[model samples]
Each structure stands twice: as C-alpha cells, then as structure tokens.
Target: MVDPRRAFALRDAFAQQVTRRLKVPAVEQRAYADRLQAALDGQTLGGLSGEYVVLVDRNANVQALFIYFRATPSDTWQMIGASPVSTGRPGEYDHFITPLGVFEHTPANMDFRSEGTQNDNHIRGYGQRDMRIFDFGWAQGQRGWGKGGISEMRLQMHATDPDWLEPVLGIRHSKGCVRIPASLNTFLDHYGILDAEYAALAESGKSLWVLKSNRQMTPWAGRYIVVVDSQRESRPAWAPAPGGKALAKVPAGASSAD
Candidate 1:
C-alpha cells in the first residue's frame, strides 16, 4: 500500500495555517458524517481516521483518496485545521470527483508567485479569494475562475497536482477545478503554509498516510494505492485492498494478513 506519509509535502503557503468559521451546524455536520459512513460502510473503498474529521471522493481511474484530519474539541474540523489538494472528475467537463479520507495537512502553504499581493498579507492569493470550500461554486461545473486572470480550480480541496492512481486526463481531465471536504477546504484557504512542524507517530512509522478507498472515484493516472478504512478480505482485513504490492521506491511497512 502506498503510504501518503511518504507523499511529498512541498512548502508553498502564504501564511502558516487556515482559518475556520463553522458555517455548518453540528447536527448537519454529524448528518454529513452519517451519510458518508453509510455510503462507505462496506462499500469497496471505505476509510476512517484516528482523527474524526475526514474527506472522501473519487480520485482518477475510479480510485479514491481519503484526506483525514482531527477536529477541535468543539467537534469541528475548523477548530483544528485543513489542507489543499487536487481531486478527480466524473467525466467530460465534470470536474467534481475526488476520494474521501482523513488526512492532516494544515494547508498553510501558499504560492505568492501565483497568489499575488492581496494574499501576501492574508497568506492567500493576489485576489484573496477564500476557497473555504465546497463553498465557492464555479457557476455550475467549469465556471470557477480566479481574479487577476487567476482561474479558480473550483475544487473543494485545492492542490498543486491531481490525486490519482492511474492516468485518465492529462491536460484535459478537469475543466477548471476539483473537489475536497468542504470544511477542510475552507480552513486551508484561510491560512497559508508558513513555517511548519510535523512528527511521526510512535505506533506508526509514517505520520502522513493516505487511506485510499477501493472504490474508484476516477482513474488513478497510473499509481498504486491501499485501503486504509474498510472491512474486507484485504491483508490488513481492517483496511481492504486488491492490487496493492510493495514498490521499490517505498520502504517496507506493515501490511494486513489475508
């Protein structure tokens, strides 16, 4: 299984962290979680996190990504923080597909070369547009654009690259955006990546790992994945999987038993 902890963490933030302002109610948030879990319960690619807050969706090639994070004591992810990422699309001009999972990114990295002056202070972009997410819709599908000719990726979780396992669309897949966990997205946009700190957990060798879903949100551009949260025949059993093997590049980590 590919450990997301092994994934690259490029420093690109205008500030240090994202801002959170709970827009959804606790009841609504819990309801959302219930719906998400219900759909994922035994579904092919289900994932959970030590942290409660999580994001799910189809990546590319029918694969899925599970970005996880911990919510504040208030039972809100905003109280904790968020991250920035690229998701997959369903199909033709349909750029609203990404996987789901619990991840911890902080989403503080900001690229001023691209963001501009306005974002300089806010650690945002030049336009200082709040991508606090699933919040800003690009009209319908592809109308999500940015200011100063800066086009909006129109994604819930905005990232630099496309989260995929195999190839689906190169320069043509997404119309103008991707999607992410609405709350997480919002938080990341508020704060940018300033100086950061990370520590690997003692129980787990890797601190940052992606709990990939067996379900294909889209086609993975041609990478490998593993199941993080599921109840299936996967070696881990707890995290079900199929074609997951060790890669020459990744280190040997513990896996599930068949």
Candidate 2:
C-alpha cells in the first residue's frame, strides 16, 4: 500500500501537470470514486492496495476522465486530477458505444505508439507520433451502425488529432475508443500512471520499448480503468460542452448531480 502522505503528494503533483483541468467539487469527486469502487466490486477486482485508477464517466453530459488513488482497499479514494475526454459517439457507421465496466490494463495486450499518420480525411486518428496507445484488447460493444448488435471491438485510449479532434474532446466523438488530450497522454505516459503491469515486467528485466525512457513512475501505478454512465439529463456547470457553455438545460425533477 502507498503511504498516505505520499499519495497526497502525488495527487498535488498530478494536478499541476494536467493542462486542461476539470474543476469538480469534492462531493462530486467522491461520487465518482463511489462509482469506481462499485464497478471494481461488481467485477470482483477488489484488494487493489495502494493503486491509482482511471475513472471515466461516459455520460454524454460529462465526458470527463478522473484520476483517483486509494492507499488501501478500504481507504477512501482521493481525486488526483481530471481532464476532458471524448468517448464513443453513436449514430455513425462503424461507431460503437463505449462499453461500461472495469477494464484491466495488462501486458497481455501490448500497447503501441501512434505513427501520427493522417487518414484519407487528413485526420490523425491517434494524435502525434510516439503517443502511447493504452490498449485494453478486444471488448464486446453495442454497435452504432444499422442493424445494431453486440460485436467485438478493439478498445484503446489515446490522444486525438490536436488540430481538429482535440478541440472537441468534451463531447462524444470516437469509433468506440476513448480519445484524450495530447498533453494528458504525455502526462500519463511520462508518469506511468496506468503502467503497473509494464513496470512489473520491467522490474523483472523485461524490456518494454513502449515505456518512455525518462518516465518517473509512481509506486501506486494502476492497472484498471473503470467506466460508468451517470445518466445525467442535462449538462452541469463544471463540465461544459464544446464551446465552454452548459448548453443543455436541466429539466424539472432532474437530479442535480450532473
């Protein structure tokens, strides 16, 4: 387990590194942490002592990723940092809704760096060259295309095209994977935030070329990314939509936990 003092220190350090901060309140942060714990418990992934975990709310109104850490299985999860992200956006052919639940990051599905090549549409689907792609292997997702049905899709989290895609990160717009900011990708990669398995392999003399040579890894390296949908009816002030405005209005009787 991580020392409590050290965990707090790491939290502060991570906060400073985030380029685009999602200013969530303490109560909301705790609520997201509660959801993370629930997902872990549902998947029987408890006992992850002193580990950091990435939590993403796939709710369209709140396309945000939260970094959380806990010193022990029974300890309250504390927020490290948060940033805007783009999850799966349905309605388009070949698009799949981002799956909900806990996904473990392991060496079984090795990660790779993006080639930074633009597609036919001149869009860099995987951001700049050398950006690490956090692969979670194949996952069954609900297809967004015609005659929609469950199908196996490759799950990955990486930086999106900086010019076009990155600016629209707060909204859902991906082919099933999670798209984050390039700065956040570098932060996660440089700190080994979710590289627990890779670190373990490297410690045993296994060379992982994907890892950055100058990475300052944390002892609380995490392996899990828990995704949940808050099902908010409207956008919250803290989580603004694309143009920095809460465009969606909250209807009467809607929950305030947007």
User: TM-score winner among the candidates?
Assistant: 2
For residues 1-258, write the lDDT of model 1, one tens digit per residue: 443232122112212322212233445345445544545454542443223223332322222233222222222222122222223333333233222332233222212212222221222221123222222222223222232222234333332211121112111133333423233343333322111221222124543222112212211111111122222222322112223331122222100000
Write model 2 residue lDDT over 29-134, tens digit each, in one string.
Answer: 9899888888888887766658788999999999999998877777888888899998888887778889998898999999999999877666778889998999
Q: Which stretches of candidate 2 lie over 4 Å from their true place?
A: 1-4, 244-258
Q: Ten-residue segment with the worst summed lDDT in candidate 2? A: 249-258
C-alpha RMSD values across all candidates: 19.5, 6.3
lDDT of 1: 0.27
What is the C-alpha local distance difference test score of candidate 2? 0.83
Clashes of each: 69, 0
